[model samples]
Target: MIAHNNMKSSPRLENEHEHENEPNNLIMKKLLSRCWEESRLLWRLAFPALLTELFQFSIGFVTTGFVGHLGEVELAAVSVVENILDSSAYGVLFGLGSALDTLSGQAVGAGRLERLGTYTQQSWIICSATAVALTPAFVFATPILKSFLHQPPHVSRVAGPYARWAIPRLFAHAMNIPLLMFFQAQSRVWAVTAISGAVLAAHVALTYLAVRRLGCGLRGAAVVGDISHWLIAAAQFAYMRGGCFPEAWKGFTVRSFSNLGAFVKLSLGSAVMIWLVVSIGYGSLEFWYYTTLLVLVGLLKHAKLQIDIMSVCLNYEFMTIMVALGFSTAAGIRVSNELGANRPKETKLAVVVAVSTSAFMGAIFMAFALIWRTSLPKFFSDSPKVIDGASRLGYLLAVTIFMSSIWPVLSGVAVGAGWQVPVAFINVGCYYLVGIPLGILFGFRLKHGALGIWMGMLTGTFLQMAILLAIIFRTKWEKQAELAKMRISEWGGKNENQPLIS
Candidate 1:
């Protein structure tokens, strides 16, 4: 209980009446209590998510770090290919995976637990089909890289083999993403955390053996991820079958294949929204290329591969920063869950607490970036030139991290509120219409290089954040709660393709 006496309580019996008359004291007490309560809720949801992102990213980071050691060619090949994959495939596929967040989170809250399994199964079909369609891109990556990207011949050659080797990742991605998203929606993330941790360790060890001991080179490094990711997918599937989700997983059913059209439309909105959100801020590696073309065009041919080193260093920071990204995911789930249950006040509190916590996390990242501005590059490479280059990029990295801390939670609110279709269009406007064109102007016309490009992206981010704030404030929370309940009833009850009657 709050110390009511700690306030300016009038000691005299006559003055004691003044305390009760003022009323501000009680208001303050209630405000403080609500903040404390909301903070606890935010932490509980975000922390496990933080662990899940950390472990998952660690496995990929280790694989990248291994490639960073194998020579400049390997570094350039792996980094660029990974960058392309992130931009083209990962964003779309993972965004589709996030569809589970929308369907299952609300389902759990609305007490429609059995629907969670069917939703997840529906995602598998979509992601699998997507993976198959995209696999050919990897097969022909060499031609695309050489013709379109203008990379050096050696980089193209090395990337070709690795691209083919990396196709298995898509298949594994198909299996793994839905499982993790299903677990996350239900808040059964400790299982994901443990499984990811084990996978991280195994991935690191196997990558060392493949690259360092067995001399697998770039192809070997890529293959290690295939093994590691499949292992994770298999393990998580086992856990699901082993009574982890007794209510949700009612074995396999034909219902999963029943809602293809509905699932596709929903997944597309989610994919586009998430892709735009992630690509503009985090996924688009090609952003660096535009800057290089602008500022370093004079030395382009001679220094084609130099940008890879900087990319590697930048990827390192992005990977570690994934922990902060968890707030967005958690916010999405909590907001959706509360809304589904028709708890309008609870939904609003979750949003407020999530935004506040994310801002605090951003400040922490800003501090870390400033302190380790120089020393942290040493973790990725020993080249003094690369280290010095990365050090110079530190200020930008810090600002990026700070922005990342806030923007994601806003995106989460959009996700939780069932505004995916509208948000996708918003992202395109913010990222492509405003961000990219302006970034190009800054990088090319202003000759500010990567820093200027990032500045443009940051401008877009804050703009998006501002618009999201407007929407959130304008939203009728009670109406959204009602919508969530109705959506759950409609989607959970019958054929998703059929139009709902008014």
Candidate 2:
């Protein structure tokens, strides 16, 4: 009778164990299903964004390729203009536009779609003014290059003309950047990609005709680029007015100009609540970091050849980094939208998928850089020395690409959370204080040249990435969601009954 009782107890215990494991297995399955869904949404935004970036960056890339074969002086001159001057302008404008990524995305998540059109219009006002202010810089670029920076005279002369011709593109950006953010907030990414592809195809043919077949040289290339940008902006505007976004876009309104003082204050405020100006600052700092690198390269002996080699490497860097930026853009949209929707877990999952996908893309590019180090530079140049110098720096470029892949995604996360102010500070500390100083030491003091400068900058990037990781690790997503709700409530109460006219 005792033995029979023991056997019965063993079976009961085993059955109890099975019952406990079932809930755990169910939870695991649920989590996996959510992860799969999050990944699908992320790619829907990311893949189109990636292609758009590729096409956009290819505009300059193709121009550089064409200019390179013209002569070394033309190549060097265009490099300075495009890399330093154009980059500075693009950085600030892009940064300003980033504000909309956060605001409009959150607005959509909160179901306040009407706010997007107004926010976009306000952005257009500010960005247009800023673009106008930036014009004199491009117009007088030669003097600044020669007098302040002491670039070679021939390079300056060519670059000056090119800069002047590139001015229209700035205004075009002012019109288009707002539209891009407006569209991305609503996941209208495929439209943007299609426009980019069409513009790029047209641009390639026109640029080829103007620069090569027509013998129009740098001026023609610049003019063609300017036209391409205008075309893109016009196309976007046409789309916005086509009644697809009836809920979000009720046509343009005078309300976009009302409360101008408050809007400016919010855009440029130093407080944590402010995002636009801080995003701009971060954008400027991030882009000017590379521009500063180019300046340092200019100061070196054998400046022209160094510029050529560095330019090729930088162009490739730009191309690969754009892929990461696509991921960055999607991350920003996803995180902000999820936070607005009060889904912190979904936001967290979105971050994971975005970072992982971008990292994989970066790895693929890195391997390509390593394997085809010698062959890659030929696409940009015919000069043997330029090709060889670039190839020698290939390993450094690979590392930079990988680091770039990770950090931009992290920056996107910060932007989504409205943490641009702190990240802007981080950028200054890392890129300016640490990276620039170390670069000077390595490039001039220790005689490592352009390679050393890049390595030092790479160090700064690594530090920035690590610090961002720490910040993300400690972030309270629930609190962020609360803040998003608060922000939407404050801004979403205005101009509901206004008459909007396109």
Candidate 3:
């Protein structure tokens, strides 16, 4: 067996590649072995991440569900408000925090444990500032919706107040993301999952009692959601500072504040990547069209005509969001780890495994969506008209889920590769220039409606995926590994010969 740790030089990596052309059976065996190894690593990080995201996603869903029970008006209000958060502030700050992942993930791979805390601290500062900058948008969400969107009276009335009530979550998410990235880098996601589980349980009870028992209406649900976010942030902050991962924490440092330029630049890139990925279609026109549909349904008072369709859209989004979150995390971590360790070939291999796995999962989602089309909407609504309407859109939802399954991992790859800046431009071109305009042309000009909007989204997603795949395939992995090493060295501290904290 080749000694990976000792084989760090250029010649060794070249020799490793030379072996790629070994007899077909030998190559196949090597590939299979790698697949198994990569799969285990990916799944460990992914499963917990999946649950954590679900728990996070559920906070909004639970609130929406409780609010949904009150009336369609309330449901529509909360939904609009929730999407307001999702499509804007949340994505930008989360992206800024994700900058820590690139630094910390590679730090872990390079055994520079102390730098993890430094990156985490820097991320916290950046994310908090970004969140503060975005707070006014949340504050004015309703007016913007009312004035800009020209929403109906009922939706416009409640949406603003509900957004104001939930404003605390914006800050909670800011603090939460740095901690989450810090922990994920060390493969300590179980901590997040456990915390998320406890938070989720508390959230469910809070939403139930606050909405149903206390009759707090939208205000109650919004307040509870804010509380959940803060609680998670506080718990994680305390745990990490207390004793968790002592090597990584090092009780905080002034060093974090020292090299502002590099960190800030990286954070901006990371923020742009997050902002683009989260807001692209999920938060952009795809969201726009869905919002338009809901408004049309509510305005026309044709709830019966579109309830099932909305339900289908919700379920599709739920499934797609979680799966995308899971795979994206997997891909980023896997690539970052291998790149840091200077295993360029293995880094490429990891991307292949992660993307393939995600694609396969997408296919499975597509199949299930198709198979269970008729029965699926029952979970969201019981009305026969709603159910029938949902059935008609089920196939379309399946196609959407398939896209959701693939693109996020590609986004993750860009994150891991530290190409967030360039990729942000790609995201804009594919999603806004290509996808959104196309959707409008088809959905409105050509009369495709929701399906047309989705087609535009799918086209954007496919283009994004293809472009990302092209970048991955054509990348010179060895140079990336080398760059990672240089970065860790630069970030670690003064003395080059000193042992890494790990």
Q: Report, for all candidates in order, the number of backbone clashes.
A: 0, 0, 0
lDDT of 2 by residue, 133-193 (tens): 9999999999999889888877898899999999999999889888988888898979889
Superior candidate under lDDT, 2 versus 3: 2
Q: Candidate 1, residues 1-502: lDDT per residue as tens digits?
A: 2567645343665587877766988888887898898888777777888888888767667776788766666766776677665335766576666667787888888887888887888888988887898888799888867776666767777788888988987888788878877887887888778888898898888899999999988878888888888888898999989986788998887767766666665655435555445323232222332332222321243444455545655575555457666887788888899998999998888888888888888898889888988997766566677677778878877877787778768877877887766666666677667777777678668877656666776677667778888888788899999999888877776553442222
Full-model lDDT for every candidate? 0.73, 0.86, 0.73
User: TM-score for all predictions?
Assistant: 0.88, 0.95, 0.85
How much is the lDDT of residue 425 in candidate 2? Answer: 82
Regions of model 3 farther than 4 Å from truth: 1-24, 269-315, 381-387, 493-502
Pairing residues by index, what is the TM-score of model 2? 0.95
**Cα-lDDT of candidate 3:** 0.73
TM-score for candidate 1, residues paired by index: 0.88
Best by lDDT: 2
Scanning candidate 1 in windows of ten residues, the lowest lDDT window is 290-299
Candidate closer to the true structure by TM-score (higher is better), 1 or 3: 1
